[model samples]
Target: MIRKLEGRTWKFGDNINTDLMIPSFALAEPEEKQPKYCFSANRPGWVDLVKPGDILVAGNNFGTGSSRPGAKVLKSLGIICLLAESINGLFLRNCVNYGLPALPCPGVFSSFNEGDIASVQLEEGKVVNLNSGRVLATTALPNMLLEILAAGGIVPLLEGKGLLDKAR
Candidate 1:
């Protein structure tokens, strides 16, 4: 259920739209190539800079644009989760659908700096700054959502239920 997520934080500011997440020109490319262009237009070389298990921390309205396939790109890049001051509803849903959890926490932006290691405990709804000893609370993930995430996304959950193979 992704009870504990720990990683270095990659901070970004407000209103980072889908285009900035993965530019439209790179949309058609395969997963192997899609990550290279992620944040390329906004933060050049960001993809190469991120390591596996890294957490993305952002300001208000993160992922505030057209609902697109950017979450898939993020998952493929190995981002474990996202903690933000606020996030667009569609984008949050998309991230969850792709098995990348995104949670809103007030003051999260003000609490941690870029590159500070952060640990999120989903069950406790707590985010801790491993570097500074600050902690913040967020909404607890619902059990159903946790189940989907544990399965690595909705498709996998459905597959586990034999729903994907059966005609609806």
Candidate 2:
């Protein structure tokens, strides 16, 4: 898995739905073409501005809407990970399946700001504010999920273990 993640933070608030991440209008396009629409509705020009490996920190209930395409879009946009106070279960599953690390850090949203340098140690559940030297604790990622991420997603994970062929 991505044990250590270091990047500039892109802060967001609570209840940021999938609609805001990847609007419905963008879903019909191909995956390679979807990144351009990520956060276009909520944060105009976000796709053009966000850099690869940038960390997204948010408040409670991040990714609350019923849309899976947003996760794919965010992954395509090169979002390294998501640190939120709480994340919707379905969205979190989507993130994991897409090889995107999503962690629950209680104080992350308030402790950091947009453009703040941040780093996360997944196994240790440590979140650090590289800009101000602040530290926060997060829920440790489960080993199974870590394995999935390490293999680059669920499909790859299954393929590595020869499970896909057997299932087929």
Candidate 3:
């Protein structure tokens, strides 16, 4: 089962490009420092403040910008998945490959402006609009990817079943 994430919320505006998601400049740093710098623009302190299992709600075009790996670098900071009106094709694909969860959720923004607690069911593929008493949208997770997300990102998933050593 996918580990559902639920807790206090944090919000973001529309067209949150990849640069803000994970600034290109941060790629120059070590991998250990990479995930820490995600979302440096729309919410500067968010990368540090977002606790594990906190739900995130964003406005339309949540990821609309250049195709960069930076946007897919936040599994460590604990952004369980993205709930927004729409997402760019490039960003969406990048997130999926990297084991990040990006769901298309149009009405999520209207339900709670931000800072409101919300519940996320990664397997049932739904985000509960807690305040509005509605389920906003379904997640776009493939079966394999759902397992990776359930195990807390890709590396943990691979280590769990011991498939990583096949190449060795």
Per-candidate TM-scores read 0.93, 0.92, 0.76
Number of the predicted model whose lDDT against the real structure is largest: 1
lDDT of 2 by residue, 32-120 (tens): 77678777767888788888989899999999998565677777788998999999998988988988888988988889979999889
Off by over 4 Å in 1: 166-168
lDDT accuracy of residue 143 in candidate 1:
80
Model 3 stretches astray by more than 4 angstroms: 137-168
Question: All models: lDDT?
Answer: 0.86, 0.85, 0.70
Tens-place lDDT per residue, model 1, 82-159, is 888898988988888889977888899989989999999876779999999998988877887777777888898878
Q: How close is candidate 2 to the true structure, as a TM-score?
A: 0.92
TM-score-better candidate, 1 vs 2: 1
**Backbone collision count in every prediction?**
0, 0, 0
Looking at candidate 2, the ten consecutive residues that score lowest on lDDT are 67-76
| Local accuracy of candidate 3 as per-residue lDDT tens digits, 5-97 | 676777777888877866788768887787777876656777778877665677877667777674456556766677777777777666666
Q: Higher-lDDT candidate among 1 and 3?
A: 1
Among all candidates shown, the one with the greatest TM-score: 1
